[model samples]
Target: MKFLFIAPRFHNNQYYWVKSLTDHNHEVRFWVWRKEPLENYSALTPSLIPRSSFGLPKILSCYREMKALDPDIVVVRDPRSFLFVFVSMLIARMQKRKVFIYSQTPLYQTMSWVKKITVRLMLRFFGSLWITPIIGDMRYPKFHPRAFYVPFAIEPQAQEKSPVRRPIRIISVGKIYQERKNHLLLLEAFYDSLKKSDIRLTIIGALSGNSPEYFNKMRVYIKKYDLEQTVEIKTNLEHNEVLREYAKHDLFVLPSSNEPLAYSPLEAMGAGLPVICSDTNGFRWYVKDGENGYIFKSEDVSDLKDKVSLAIPRLQEMSKNSLNSVKQFYTPKSFYEKFMEAVQSV
Candidate 1:
């Protein structure tokens, strides 16, 4: 099948999926906002409409390019990209081609009221919606019957083995969003638990827009509590560098108060590291208490500390279980097969 993946950027996940589909003998093309500076993939080209140009010109150009492709299926990456997806749907509808959307969040729960209203409006036009199976009880089909839950696929290379390092290093990977990611919560929990124990946490990700201010505040808390050596903060690294970080860490910690799908936890599991995540709907999908990893109450310092203490002793066992869980549940083949079944069923 000829597939056109329309996304904002050709980053790690986008590149992984497009490459996976193509390797499976499917003709895959991309309509993306920017070309990744580091890698060269001849299959992808500049999107017809730059994401910056917000007007009728962008819409018509995207529509024309999509129509020209005449793809069998066009998958839009997220709800924010729905405008372009809407245009693709219009053109695809005229050509009788199928349109699908990949949504990672619950509409009513995650977005602001205004954004929710807009999402509902655009959702009415989409043929189908895809989300991760772990999205606990967000009530996806409350309005649109076409919505389905399909987990994201990790790169095959992400599943490889890495030599374990000592000193019990814990890493958190993803965008650093205050209140949302709850990095402060992670630090507090880790600090409290390590009063007698020995463990270190590395906060690695691109800080949010207000991260500099947040980081300064966190530093105050760290110094006041004397957790300077307990927690370290850093920004985003290159893809391979992040992977190397993953390989070194003994466990993955995501103390997010509110997350839609929580991609970092999945990637951590894929890399054979156990996880301790917030008890949010998305993280609950895989972090089954004693199964793969453990879950803690969101923003509850005591609860998080207890879980972290429990996790440290069983790192090796939990890491193996986490890898097993990803292999059994979140494999690339499973992701593509289930998604393809849903697409073809439409």
Candidate 2:
């Protein structure tokens, strides 16, 4: 089947999906709306209307492009977002083309009234618009009937032998978002729980997040608490290098609240690292408590600390479980098969 994706950027796990589909001889094409200078996939050309452009030009330009490609399915990244999604949906509605909303799990509870009305209207225009959520949470469909699970797949790189790294390195990989990632919570948990213990935290942040103050606060806490040597901060490393850092770590902890979907924990599990994430992570379903990892309360320093402390001793056992879960649950084949099923099942 020929598939055309309208997304913000063509970087990250989008690479793996594109590669997988093309390898299977499925004609795949994408139109991106932003610039990713890190790696140029030349075919991932910019849309006629750049994301920065506003008003009718954005809609017309995207609609024209959608009409031109005329793929079997139009995959809009999200239904809630501006620009691309509305335009794509408009074109799909006009052209009578099938739309598979490539999406994160919808947080229906916290949605604003305007957004709720907009999303419902979009769904109304196209009856039973299939939603392919990256987060594999079945509860989502209970909230919205059309949501179907199409989890993000990554190439597994489980360490051959679980090497016991000393000082117990813990890594938190995400863009620095004060309102989003909750890096401060992770830091506080580290200081309160394992300050005197032989454990180290390595925070690797992604670029493009507008939260410099949050990053600065982390430094202040480290200095004020005299945790200069105990905490390490690195930012904007290459994708492969980030994967390498995963191998050097003992556990993955995501202390964020209301995270839509985080790919880092999946990648960490793929690398055979156990996870300790907050309850609010949209992808928490993947982290099996006491098996692969434990889930703590969101923003609860005490619970976070307790989970971390509990995770320290069972790292080796949980590492194996994480790898096993990745093999069974998160494979390239599974992703492709489910994607095909989602499109064809209708």
Candidate 3:
């Protein structure tokens, strides 16, 4: 099968899918809007028409690429690529090809009517298939029959069998923003429960370019609580370095509120660390609450503190369960199998 993907940018997760498809003898090409190099995939960066210019050149470029590739399947990954997807759908219809849309955006009942109508029209008339990472996302109105769920996959690493540290190392990885990630809540919970205990906290993430205020707020909170000695805040580490940091930690905590599906916890699990995250994340689908990890109420510092306190003692058992869970459900090989099944069904 010949597959072409239209994506906003290159992501680490996409590498597994591309490699799997190629391994299965499928010719895959990626058209990315961002002018960045992808390590091993056959990816191209096409010139995009600025929105101020009415987007005709962008549509033309996409159409030309679609005609040239002539793929059996076209996967669209960004909602902002609707114009490109619409053009591809038209060409696919004439050539009897299939197109699939990868939706990671969180849809909620509080969305504007205009946005809802636009989504309905896109799925109803233009989209050939809808692929979502979470099952709950497939419950949108007018999404049956075409919607399919596929779990996100990561490359499994050889985890080191190390004894749990005495001063428990807890780590959280995400953008250092309080609104989306609720890092302050985690800080509060850590202070309330584990400050006096033999536990240390490490917050790792890139500071948002637009929001230095939130980053400053985190620094102030750390200073106010005199946690400078017990807590560490590291920013802007390379991907491999981040993974190494995960290995150094004993447990992972994700206190994010309103996340679509976070990859950090999955990476943590792959690194053989037990996870304690908010129940709001879509990836909680794999968390068997108290089996592999624990899930606390979103934004509830008290509940988070209780969950963290309970999980600290059971780290070794939970760590084993976490490894087994990733092997059973979140591996790249399993993802490829499920993706192939979905393609055959379509």
Query: Model 2, stretches more than 4 Å misplaced?
Result: 36-56, 106-121, 134-146, 192-194, 207-211
Encode model 1's per-residue lDDT on 106-187: one tens digit a residue.
4223445786566566555654454444445555333234556566666433444554555778898766646577877777
Q: lDDT for every model? A: 0.68, 0.74, 0.74
Backbone clash total for model 3 is 0
Per-residue CA lDDT of model 2 for 87-181, tens digit only, reads 76677778888877766754333456786676677667853455544445444333355656676777777454366677888999987635478
Clashes of each: 0, 0, 0
TM-score of decoy 3: 0.84
Q: By TM-score, how accurate is candidate 1?
A: 0.81
| Full-model lDDT, candidate 3 | 0.74
Candidate 2 vs candidate 3, TM-score winner: 2
List the pairs of residues colliding in candidate 3. Answer: none
Pairwise lDDT winner, candidates 1 and 3: 3
TM-score of candidate 2 against the unseen true structure: 0.87
lDDT of 3 by residue, 1-346 (tens): 9988766655655766777778878888876645432223332223332232554425555566667778989787745455654555565666666778787644322447786676667666666666766655324543445666676776666764388978889999988855688888888989954558888899998775677898888899999988988889998776677878988898999999888788788889988888888888876776879987899999898899888878888999888888888888878788888777778877
Query: Which lDDT value does model 2 have at 327?
Result: 84
User: Which one is best on TM-score?
Assistant: 2
TM-score of each: 0.81, 0.87, 0.84
